[model samples]
Target: MQRDKFLKEIENLNHPNETLVPTHCSYCAMQCGMNLRVNTSTNKIIGVEPRYDWPVTLGKMCPKGVTAYQQTNHEDRLLKPLIRDDASLKGTKEGFREATWDEAYDLIVKRFKELQQNYGKDSLSVYGGVSMTNEKCYLTGKFARVALQTRYIDYNGRFCMASAAGGINRSLGVDRGSTLPWTDIHETDCLFLAGSNTAECHPTSMFRIWAVQERGGYLIIADPRETPIARRADVHLDLRPGTDLALANGILHLLIENGHVDEEFVKNHTNGFEETKQVVKEFTPEYTSQITGVAPEKIIRAAELYGKAPNAIVLFARGIEQQVKGVDNVSAYINMALVTGNIGRPKAGVGTITGQGNGQGGREHGQKADALPGYRKIANPQHVKEIAEVWGIKPEEMPEAGVSAYEMFGLMEQKTIRSLYLLCSNPVVSAPNSNYVRKMLKQLDFMVCVDFFLSESAEYADVVLPTTTWAEDEGTTTNVEGRVIKINRAQKPLGESKPDWQIQVELAERLGRGKYFSHLKTSKDIFDELRRASKGGNADYYGVTWEKIEKQNGVFWPCKSEDDPGTPHMFLDKKFYHPDGKAKIFALPYTPPAEEPDEEYPLRLTTGRVVYHYLSGNQTRRIQFLKDMSPEPFVEVHPDTAQKYNISHEEKVRLFTRRGEVIYKVKITEAIRKDTVFVPYHWDFERAANILTNPALDPISRMPEFKACAAEIEKIEVKKVQ
Candidate 1:
């Protein structure tokens, strides 16, 4: 029965397999839809044209989206599977050699079986990425437990949105980004951005940002650097690194003292209001100014602007999330929004600026340490029974939740997990304390990586299997607003690469677990079962169908049945999903970063992204145009700090942290605070920012503090040319 179902679905598959296939960009969470101009005769991606009718961006796209098609035909794309060359026979002593798909699959199954028998099932681990489609993520987690039967599994979204998820789950009873539709941003009367430089990171979202200004709304930006987006704000509170929680407390304190809080909403729809009010009483603007580097007047001014606005939003990104106090930082922002009665309405709430392609959908459909498909809990017996039934397995067949992303690597150092399987991520470059992470990778008994290119992390693997790219596959990804949209295939797979789903299914077939996975053929086939698995869960998609997504631009989730219209705005009835139908207002206190500045390491080093590249620069850096725009790594130093260190603009300098140091060319600017230095975290190998970042994680979120670490600078004397 299962084999027949798989064959039928594969025979009736739908995706980017032909000319003019409609798909979305695979870069950011925006997921702007575009049509691939393909030449079916030669099965080549010719060009890209905007799908202007889609409401998300109105057909507008960033530079990356326009040039994304070039990657399909790029010369450097992997044409075949590559197995690590043995010491006896090889062109390069320690590199890979071309191999057939069968050879790659044989190596994977043989090594994994040997390791599982010797070190036990727990020795094999799986680490996935947020860029994968919802079906792929769910299948990866299931494959790990059902096929490998290992308890270790997680994804890269842990580094992107785990803190926000933790904060929202505890306070609001749910964790979907921007509970309202994407159009709500246009209706907001005031918007505050913390740690996010949206103008550069998500350029397509500018339509909503400008809409607020066009309607005379106020904008406030809080960051150590005055980025291009901050320049547009009415008030820019350039706070010191690791001071986000302090600044949020100060804003709320001012709002409460000025009688700006919505007392009615506090009394009826929330818990812990009195406690939060008591805590913010001591966070005056002056005290906040001493902690954060912002002036007292600016804090008060920004608070007043937001407090007076009828509709407001509090937006944050990795700047606030990638920290030791990440959850506390996010809870503070949510506290302010709830206190002002800014959410549960048209355009007032908290929204996370997701960084990865399917970060939203990835987290919603399992792949996290403690989560199951449809955001179900691993410990919840009812959720387990329902999902187990869908997969034709018993409730006990599912494994328990494992450690988080960073903790998984820590286990590798202990040799607990001997085999490693990575999908769609380059953790060797992106994980905190990457030098330590690489050492952990070297400790693995066997490693396999599935990706379109030989990424930095993949370069260390025993077997590298090629997978289909965005231009040649079809799947559905939920955008930042929780809208599920379909991406159609534009052309046939290049060379011998297959879709990620096919790879997992075939691997399962080879491992003697074919019965459970035989039904998953096409993405839609997997989605059909996913709908049944997700039924009655928070991220329910029972009513959504491939037919609906193709007919409409996209549909929002929690659409319970076919007759039910999609939910565009969450909590429209002003009731949260908490047990008592009321949201909780947390009274989180301000705390300093795990590592602080001292006399020896006198400056704070913070890392971030650039307009020309995305995370770790595995894909964007390969593109010639993007590389040309932002070539090489440089540190942004304040003019005053440069003088103190005897450094000049465009001169060689060394930034030293307790962990390590890297040489970078200095670019002096007044836009940054004198005590803080900003370095883009895109480049890898010798130029990666994670090389100097602290791995101290949030107790609740387990997110590393990549935003703030203590460091100092020294001028590297450059010799003149003869």
Candidate 2:
């Protein structure tokens, strides 16, 4: 009774609290639903926690979600529009001059029109940043199609999920919507995670995998390094980098030899089974083991576990797709799922995990090189007609297929792409081959960047338009699981910064394209238009509207009608989008890395993310706390290699590749493989990993091999201070 009275008295204490509003995570594509508890009295977000009712996130969010509010308050945020006053020269006295929104929009319109008149529309390229909301993405696509009449439009997904989209599009008829019921992770008896480190990257989603493993279910982890997930896995296969296709094919071979395949499922639900089987027969365990570096017996055991398990989920990430053989690797994994009857059902399918925050949502709304809204292929006559009618333009006017991201940069170097309008992306630090990207930027006649910060790439911009961050804006985003969520405005725009859509719309109107850039008052108007475009398409998101979403936490796509419940998982039935209602299977083969270590560079360098920082350190690096924890970039070398080279921990080391060299501190550890060294690529100055990265790209996807690059490392002796 005394304890109860004390608790009641504590609860009754008069303390002001903020009004909590519902929102979505802005960090990654997971788009975890969250609640922003704002201090109404102070006009600041005091706390952020997950929304319990959302089925996808399930009240789980990563650290990035909880701390996203910091981005709004970060000192480095650009609060006003900046225009370059001096000439466009690198390291020049050309600093940014603050401009009003009207001035910025007017100048942008004048330049775009001048460029169009001077050069063909094909000469202008528009690159969308995936972090923008679906509403913003819709407006961007509209601007490219209706205003500029430029078919040379694409998003950053070409760098992140191109192979996943391309390979899946060829086989399953739809590029990027999840075929793997993601929520089915709870029901999965065995989870095979390849190339992804869930614990560090997708922390909240890993709960499902952890639950399965904790219940005596098996978890197979395949990666070059012994990541946190790999250490906790039931079976860890440290396969060689860029050899994922070999292992996937070997697994299929084992399943075929052991007769573990479901013939009935294959015959009823799939096509190309006979040819797939014949192809797998040649990829014997012995043959693949030699290439993938996995023992034949171990491959058989891994296959048996996956094939025999009642429910199995195979998840892949950029580690498999950011390679010259990325398309092949994705095909090999998808083929395994089809052969073993692991798809089109709950808890069993091929899952392609995206890297960027809004990669899925961005692509879903016509942000790809060869795709329009709703995952519709530009080559398809029907798809082209549908989009053409919606945009009030002739289908024939659209470019057959614009250049991919890698090709776009290559064209910039060759002087084919003279002008570029970059929205929300920092290509200087994020794109592979950092030095090459920097040099190409210098070659461009005009480059415009719209972002919240003066990022690494913004340094070369002829014009920089300050844009609002997530906290200062209102929009919607989609998660990795195809779940759509909203981003609520918790505060006003920082100084002169405006929402991305507003800036683009304002510019479009100024350029006399007001008809296409109409309905710019609110995000709701833009979202309603997106819904109209999605009607009857592969990803029908008609069920959701601004009114409906505001009343609830969120809704997933394929909500085609008013009474329809948003789709939880796609492709639950055996029916596919193909003509015959069957998914095609492609046989993928392993291809070596673009650059291989030789006598001059006798080591392999692998680049990846750090726990504290995100890609290129655009936002996270600005945080003093995060920066303090990870002050400088460092190279992780194995103990044996470090000892052989007489390198000590914290000692400066020079790493050299064919392209360039960088110096970083040595971090000797057993976690890294013997001949391989691990380096975080987020740093800008001391050791930019992209400087030494391979620029070779996948044939089908056009994504460069940012993960695997050949290099050599040596200890650099410091001279004694005078």
**Top TM-score model:** 1
TM-score of each: 0.96, 0.94
Q: Give the TM-score of candidate 1.
A: 0.96
Tens-place lDDT digits, model 2, residues 552-657: 5556677898777676665787877788988887755456787776887888888888767777788887775677777778899989999999989989899978
lDDT of 1 by residue, 1-722 (tens): 74785575445333344456778998899998787777666788866779877888889888888888888878878889999865222212267889999999998999999998888889999999988887888788788878888889999988888998888778889888777787788888998999998999998888899889889998899989999989888999999999999999999999999999899998888999889888878889999999998999999999999999989999899899999999989888999988988888778888888899898889987688888888898889988888888888898988888999999988988889888899999998899888888888776888888988878888778888999887788888888888888888887898999888899999999999999999887888988877887888988988889888877778888778877668878787888989898998888788899999999999999998888888888888898888988988899999999888888999988888988888899999998999999899899878988899999999998999999999989887768999
Clashes of 2: 4
Question: After TM-score superposition, what is the CA distance of residue 178 in candidate 2 from its true location, in Å?
Answer: 2.5
- C-alpha RMSD by candidate, in order: 6.1, 3.8
lDDT of each: 0.87, 0.78
Model 2, which residues run further than 4 Å from truth? 1-17, 88-94, 547-553, 720-722
Q: Model 1: which ten-residue window has the lowest total lDDT?
A: 85-94
